[model samples]
Target: PSLATLNIPTVWFNNPNVSYSKANLGEELLKFEIPRYTEWVRSTEAGSFHCDDTGLICEVKEAVTLTYYFDSWPKLLEEQNTEELHVAGPLLNFKVDAAEAVASICIPHFLCLEGEDSSHVYIAHFVEGEMRLEKPDRVEPHHAVLENPKFSSLGVVFKKWFKQKINTVVLLYHRLHLETPTFHLYLLPNDPSIIKVTRNLHLWYSRLPGSFA
Candidate 1:
């Protein structure tokens, strides 16, 4: 699928001193299998995983498979109070037959904001087609800790009333075959929703007459 059709977000690095890393870019999907008698497991990117006493892993007589993947923000969430609630990281989903087995999940993020604090970051849980914001047990610059009672769509969000500068990337698209030689510039946050919107706009503009020089 083309970039315009895909739901994935675009990532760019503007720093001359920094090299690009593919592992850090794009949506990631990972799967793991827990032995029937296993008690704990660790995922390098998703953090440590554990099952509760009443969890499926404890009661079930067979092994279980866990699937973790990054997802895009739902339209319902994007239409809300975006100024007050900003997505700070990739939206993620954890799928397993044993939703009751999940005890806690630690989601990692790539946001680096100025004057960062735990009060502003939260876990956005998409439950029953509704967006529910929950506070994490621990919030740091790199990740947030959450007690996962149930599995659903989850991501990190930042709430702030005041303006603050954050480390971000800028995407510049040059319009070709134009008489005036136009160039479109977008200053976007690290949020996937915003990136997806910007990429769609870019694709639309690229198809216009005289866009290519």
Candidate 2:
């Protein structure tokens, strides 16, 4: 379709309710429906849709907005073991890796949110040089998106918090008298069980010989 005739809004492309099953339906039906939907929005001047030459643009107004800031903790290097601390709502200490043999360095960053509640944690493994967004090993992110997403109101709230947060990366490489270990981020749900699991993992790591700085 020509750009001039593409009167459809861009938001419609993402809406699951709208069907793009051309094989199931005839072109004539699509030809009729597209223009009809386009005309309806243009005539009504809906709040979500704005008519332009290319197509429609959706302007979704948000409700409450929260913000957060990030600061690197240099004094934390003196601590015996690595522990996750809540820096802010969106910005957090994902991980801190260090070694006593060489130098203990800490990298800080904020995870990117894909949707409400659901966000990605960036794990940095210098030995492998294969750093990317974290996801379930079995589920490919591209394929997972094709399936229906389980939306949560709590997730939406978290998503908004992340969207409004200050995104900054503080890479502080310091040679400490402590251990040289690597740090990484762990994504856990805001559930009671997960909280318990995190505590247990902390205890387990503490028991490991020379696990802490």
Candidate 3:
């Protein structure tokens, strides 16, 4: 299943003025309006902006209207690597007037399959048409911390090992007709591209005769 399919809840900020919007490509945008830099910093110190749903923590150096965008396993990065690489988190993009900020996000437990080594996970930073893999500053049971000097597109990725058992979901549907009933079963990865394609195909199939009643 894709992140979009999961319908993950959006992050909520302590500041009620924070606004949110969603892009057609399934990107989540969050805008923070801060009146005072000092107060904002104090709130961050108090962990008022940490989002439990998405496990996102952002700390800025200066007070600024921050605009953040998150896309789960974006397709834009599909061609980044010819080799197989599994994504563990969403792509984080942000715009701020500040010079630097630290961002951290929790890798979904399902993506970090049981028995998989945490040390093998890395943060993939996309800059200047290049992707750089870096080790996280801190790794917790469910979170990976990164000190980002410059932020563009950052996500967690890992090389899939042979026989690595990934936790997955299976979908089943039945088509009923006068002649006979047919069942369709699908085994899918937790990838956005595959999910999107599968959804489109399912929609097409639903339009045919003897579809789900």
| TM-scores for candidates 1 onward, in order | 0.51, 0.18, 0.50
Candidate 3, which segments miss by more than 4 Å at Cα?
Answer: 1-103, 107-110, 113-115, 138-150, 160-162, 176-179, 191-197, 200-209
Q: Candidate 3, overall lDDT?
A: 0.48
Return the lDDT, model 3, position 4: 26
| Model 1 TM-score, 2 decimals | 0.51
Clashing pairs in 3: none
Worst 10 residues of 1 by lDDT: 15-24
lDDT of 1: 0.51
Instruction: Report clashes for each candidate as comma-separated counts.
Output: 5, 14, 0
Better candidate by TM-score, 2 or 3: 3
Q: Write one digit per residue (lDDT tens) for candidate 1, span 165-201.
A: 4545577777676567666565555444345445544
lDDT by candidate, in order shown: 0.51, 0.22, 0.48
Ranking by lDDT: 1, 3, 2
Error of 2 at 6 (Å): 36
What TM-score quantifies how close candidate 3 is to the native fold?
0.50
Tell me how far the alpha carbon of residue 90 in candidate 2 is from the true structure, in angstroms, after superposition: 22
